[model samples]
Target: MYRFTGSWLHKALVRLCASLLAILGLKLSAFYFLGLLIVLGLHREQLLG
Candidate 1:
């Protein structure tokens, strides 16, 4: 019974960590995309002017 509970807890913890990492990764990618867009806009303006 104790071993079963331990395994359940471990699985829950792993799932929690995976979700947290996924959220962090999504945020990082969003920021990266925003920065890329900003840079591209500036480059476009420079080329036009």
Candidate 2:
């Protein structure tokens, strides 16, 4: 397991990476969004620390 630490820059990079991945490949886009769903919603605690 991993936790996203640091600051707002990390958050921006995550969003940037999400958009970039979505634009780069179809398969990656699917997996990235699903992971985003799991991280952003299902496992909110991971980001709070």
Best by TM-score: 1
How many times do residue backbones clash in model 1? Answer: 0
Can you write out model 2's per-residue Cα lDDT over 1-49, one digit (the tens) per residue? 1454455668999999998887878877789999998778756776665
The per-model lDDT (C-alpha) reads: 1.00, 0.79
Let me know the TM-score candidate 1 reaches against the reference structure.
0.93
What stretches of model 1 exceed 4 Å from their correct place? none
**Model 1, span 12-33: residue lDDT tens:** 9999999999999999999999
**Model 2 lowest lDDT segment of ten:** 1-10
- Return the TM-score for each candidate structure: 0.93, 0.37
